[model samples]
Target chain A: MSVEPLDPSTLPEHDNLPGNAHAYCVRLTGPLFVQTGRMIAHYPAGGGTIRFEPLTATSLGTLVAERFSSPLYSRDWVVANGQGHVLLGDRGYDINSYDLDEGNLTVRAANLLAFDAGLELKESIVPGFLTLIGTGRFLASSSGPVIFVEPPVRVDPEALVGWADCPAPALHFDAGWMGHFLGAARGALFGTRSGEERQYDFTGAGTVLLQSSERLREDPHALRRLEGEVRQLGPGALQQLQAVVQQQLAEHQQQQR
Target chain B: MSWRLRTPRVLVVDLDGSRGSAVRARTGSMVACEGEVSFKDAGIGGGGGLRAALKQRVAGESLPLMEVSGRGSVHLAVEAGHVLLLELAGEVLRVESESLLCLSEGLRTDVAFTGLRGASSGQGLFTTSVTGHGRVALLSLGGPPIALRVTPRTPLVVDPDAYVGCLGEVRQSFVTDVSWRAVVGESSGEAFSLRFEGSGTVFVQPEERR
Candidate 1:
């Protein structure tokens, strides 16, 4: 609900973080620290909301350590080997995996609320917490909560629509089966069976939000057709198309917020 | 006692006191009944006519003949009933309870049974047919009939079993070739796709069984 604001001058250092985008800095003043893409920073002593400007690439390490240690630092937790872990608020805990090689530690928060890449974190009404990491797309949803962490993986967005937190299920179908049903030679191109890909079904009370690369490939023909339709339309039709696109963009923006 | 006519595509029956009845049409003829009659068929070619028999059946009187048209017709005797007639036209499926029958000759016809799940449910027998061309009218249980328009640029795909009508303006193609082994493979039952290209409309129901 309400969070304490942080002063940027006292903020720790971080490098290679996005500039121009708003950030939040929490000071832990210890060897171990963490940085996140969310706003509401929490610690055992107290938690508050803070905003930070983007940091230069050189300061990234200090910034990450401060953010990571801020929560545990207040709890009187000792930093060993440049790493600290802490229970995140009353609802969840954070397992800060600090990778020195990457110069960033992944703060995996569980059972709190909502998180976004814009350094804004909101309390979740549904019994759940938010987790922020360095990679993947920002996910926001109300469906369920089960964050399946398979880094360096890409998935289809449309296919990922209902799946928020679980590993993608194994898809089964042979080329012969595909040829018979679609009257085509190969089945690998088109997925077989309508509802067989249920491996990504996230089971929990909250929503699972995922950013997937596979989304770009879903219904390629449909997108192409829509684009062509927009292109072929005259000035009047173009105006209508533009209006629809604007509406969709606005909806996406709202969801991010 | 009931007499079902598989040949000549017609069925003649007498309802003693049963709740259900059956009928078949031969030579594209239509039959009108007083009570609700369940229609099923092995298969019937399209186009025909059906009219109510004016004379009622008595104890020992001459058997009344209903004016029937088309290739085949089926008549079911029921107690205290409402008349429901079904017709199959090419590209259009129509059901009319109060209209006269003058179906075309290009459509195909069949009969099947359906059931609804949940409370207050029972098996319902109904006549389902497919038409190639022309418009088929269906009498709704309530409310006014809703008209949906489909055009060349906008083609609609529907389940073949639930297809109520079509404009016959498009072409149908299979998504894949038909082969015995292919059917057993992953694609199997889903392999055959009725591809509709060109301008036209295909009517479909929400639920379709593969």
Candidate 2:
């Protein structure tokens, strides 16, 4: 018996193919489905059919890189979908996204860390770090042991607070010199050097999540000044300030809602 | 024949220098005679001459304890089975009582106020005249007796309730208007204050509201 090749335009798209599945496919004009942990898919009108295409090791590596390279984009609010929540600051993320499976989530950006199933990430103005607080599998771009957390764990973002160890450690320079050097190469002599005065870097193992934007460590001096302002307010004033901040947050959340 | 009477606490004087002689009563219960006794004038004095003249009139002997009933009665249980009761028909003046701490020494004493003001203000200006060297004792309710010492240099402020005793020579001025409004409450801006000057001790209680 001879089988005809299906056309890509007529078929549904399956972005991340789970590794556990023996084979998975979506027919043109028909349902795209998976049969590994369970049969999963969405089908069109009646013409579609599926065929088993067993994933090879090379294909799995390609799939991981593709997924990591892109940011998760949803037209509808991600939190509103009941999949997961996002907290931009010191607060914890209240994730309600069930049926959601995490692939090898990579956090490679500067001063970023994640703990607790990648739900809680603390972003500081000073050296940036990510702390995970839930028992789940997570990967990092730096040389850190794979952390398996139990429930109710509090991972300190500062613990993972290190710069990416790279040849261009001078990438983490004070804002004054960095700005001057970037504007023109004339002040490149004053630019930060590698070695004793080099920028701290984290390198070795694990995948990391990096924001497409600049990392906090790019300007350590400015970050320190910002952190100092927050620290000088003291605990009492910090609470009152937090309330005001939370109000602004609520407004932002309402806008998103 | 005539005999002289002598006692450790008082100097009993008789015109005839006779012992146990009945003296003539001139005004009310006061007896007058051509006799001299050793006593000190401790009340507020107008001047040297006036103080001297007032000091010459008082009899220093241990007078009989007069019984008083109605109101504002001052009584002291003295030594030798004698109780001193000062009955005030009008405001008593220029008198000093022995300090309560030194009760054993009956002769050496301090001054006190007996019924300076009557309960009824309707009575038309009643005043008792005293021309002598004497002392009076007063009783204060609540708490132990507080001794406020007043010297020429040291002055004190006291609540009226805590005033137990005062020197006859010390001048007194009343102070009022210390309230929450003048201190802690919202109306603290328009608060009032009291100024006390001169040589006098003022006693104050810890809890004034009660």
Highest TM-score model number = 1
lDDT of 2 by residue, B16-108 (tens): 233222221111221222434222222232122333334322322111222111112111222221111122222223222211211111122
lDDT measured at residue A248 in model 1 versus the true structure, 0 to 100: 86
- For each candidate, give its TM-score against the true structure: 0.22, 0.19
Model 1 lDDT tens row, A160-254: 42222333233344455655567745535345555333233333333333422221213213354466557778998788878989998998999
Give per-residue lDDT, candidate 2, residue B25.
15
What is the CAPRI rating of model 2's predicted complex? incorrect
Per-residue CA lDDT of candidate 2, range A1-257, in tens? 01121222322232211211111222222111111111111122223212212222122334323322212111100110111111111001111111214422223233221122223232322333322322243222222223332212222333332222121111244566566557866645644543223333434443222222231234323444466679778789999989988998998999998
